[model samples]
Target: MRRSGCGSARVRPVLAVAVSVLVAGALVGAGPAGAADPPDRVDNPYAGARVYVNPEWADRAAAEPGGHVVAGQPTAVWLDRIAAIEGTDEAMGLREHLDAAVAQRAELVQLTIYNLPARDCGRRAPQGELSIEEIVRYRAEFIDPIVEILAAPRYASLRIVAFVEPNSLANLVVNTGSRYTATPACEAVLARGTYLYGIGYALARLGAVPGVYPYLDISHHGELGWPDNSGPMTALLLQAATTAGSTVANVHGFVANTANYSVLREEYFRADDVVNGQPVHLSKWVDWNPFVDEVPYARHMRELLAGRGFSPEASVLVDTSRNGWGGPARPTGPATRHDLNQYVDSSRIDRRALVGNWCNQAGSGLGQRPATEPEPGIDAYVWVKPPGGSDGASGQPGLGQPYEPMCDPYYNPPRGSPYPTGALPGAPPFGEWFPAHFRQLLANAWPPL
Candidate 1:
């Protein structure tokens, strides 16, 4: 969705400083709260299931987002709560400020590391995706440090996830807009097979932290089809990466999965509209958003992985700051023209549309789901995108900016509601649809998560 609607409540710097002091006291083992219950360990979807939650952005200041979403709380006080972040949007380099912020918060973080060299993934899309010929050079230029991080002692546990190309190699294939498939010779090979191999190669050469692994957010740059070729895609990517270096048959897993099952519901405008399928099915992507059909997808993904003797953990982080909540409050017809880029700011490229690879929307409320089933492993559902970061022209280009001013604070419903159960002043209904639509129009733009 485009980054518009439901503006935020700014978190003043003074309050942020105060909170930092309080949080720092706790970390040093002297807070009145007394250690915060060891951080609430839950059932491990992958035995050590850990969900990564990136801070809003270094520029926004944790204090601001904290004061916004966590309102009344100083971000400084919650610095230790940070887990991971999407370091950059372009195929350039990591944002040092964002990196520092993540490193400061979570002991580990995932930097949208890439394998594209002599070619850009996002910025330079038509460069033939990522060529095998460039793999070595790509690794030399981009992957060296990830390996070091896994081996580094001071930050041995400090980790990063190499989500090769904001779009997986699958995006390289013709047609399907990078949506996965198990058919066709080339598509299957590039996605279901080679991709993972490349990841493993990076891991072997770069070394993933013992507790960490390289994961594929395959849908980062494209839409997904049913019976997602996720299993095969994962296998191939890891196989390619590992085979490139390791003999251990090291398997790379998926960190995020797509659940883009949306219903095209319509609001009643006139009785004639329904007769002609006016309001209903008019919008195409109505009630459904990324997590709309997630559980089913997860189940399928789990079955596929487990069948291959792999137990993987997936992370469900929401890009909440600006996704339009409230479902399809209005109705649209088949030609209704859904706009995923509604919040995009044409004036500036800083639009926060969920266009391609970003998946933390408000409607996907899996965070509140209790850890019941474990067959298809899932550790935790977290708020990946902090609320209040302007969609476009809001933050730094590569390092996306936070929803400025403040976070639109409100309670997200407990569970199983079209929207989160609790009330959130949250952005408008389906406001995020615009940017995604905008990106889709661009031949090079990727799809929303």
Candidate 2:
């Protein structure tokens, strides 16, 4: 299965010239003492930078009970459709957000560039406006405008991190073949090569902007952790990086679990643990996947990318937005049971019925608050997927979002082992705020809000 999930300025005369000189010097890597460094010069864009806190998201968060605790924290601004580039009825436009970022004096801004043609092709919760044949429209109408905004002179001072199309590549890996989970939509996406073209085009155009760093999304551990899936996924990434006038140089790094709820780490159990002569990988939960959580999966994926001639400096980012499985049910230690399945289940912190269940999960909690260099290969643990945004509607269809059985808490898949979706009830459509879910996250925050 596939997982899925801006601004401006002004000035004066002499004072403006002085500000312009400072900014230009910084951009060209010729700044004097204390001037900002060029984006290429920075090893980690997040380092020593104030992450932009979108006031729009902050307002929504603050309105909820106990939401002030995380209202000020940084979350990504998602441009899911072309309309979001210009202001929508419900949200600010790309330039408006960049303008707000400038006003906030934010050193870094994150944007989820997610409007690829046939996006989320494997599922139907959040569908894109572009048809599979609309790659030109995707390039001209969607990515090109965003690239123009990002490349504009006024936003040069801000380090813009563009998460290029989460799950777009990963879907090409798992959702296209004759595998049980494959769908015709995904097959069409693969057959037409739209996802690769769209992603490569976005990366190349965005990367051309000196201030924009594009991090392609590799889906979560549950999706791409297996050897077969990870290998082909890396290959597909390289293919995309080289397609449409792009190259590996265009990729600054990659982000994993972008809106999925896979745990950042399983503190108690591991994939190699042995119980009664049976390995943990044999368990239904582990299912022979080498990774048990996102951290290892991300680090290993980085190695895979590097092995395939990606930049050795390419770092990884993990979405810690909602994978904190901290609550009374969270396991404090490994299980004492000798049975492999029992040991794996009792010791795991990811409380989802199945790792494949990507939705507004019932017991998920707020994970690690955004932090830089939290792990070896990880540049930052970020709230890329804002906490409390519904994954999809549970049952009924919403305006653009079709009803997905994966989002249904009561539905069981035909192929995967039968289990309830474990999704929270009353979820709104994807990207809509769910106040009850927000309260649940706050209450069960891992580090304790």
Leading candidate by lDDT: 2
Clashing pairs in 2: 6-98, 7-98, 7-99, 8-98, 8-99
Taken over the whole model, the C-alpha lDDT of each candidate is: 0.32, 0.79
lDDT for residue 441 in candidate 2, whole number 0-100: 89
> Candidate 1 lDDT, tens digit per residue, 147-241?
55444444333334333333454444322235342234344435444444555565566433453444444442124423343544545443544
Ten-residue region with minimum lDDT total, candidate 2? 23-32
TM-score of each: 0.48, 0.91
Report the lDDT tens digits of candidate 2 across residue range 1-449: 22222111222223322232222111122222223445554768887677777666666666678876777778888888888889756567889878876765667789998877777883567657787888899999999899998877777788999899888888778876877778898888888888888888888898888889899888988989999899999999999999999999999999999988899889997898788988888899888998999988888898999999899889688888888888898988888967788788889999987888888888889998888887688889888888877778787444444788877777876656477888788877777888888889888889777
TM-score: model 2 vs. ground truth: 0.91
Displacement of residue 331 (Cα, Å) in model 2 is 1.0
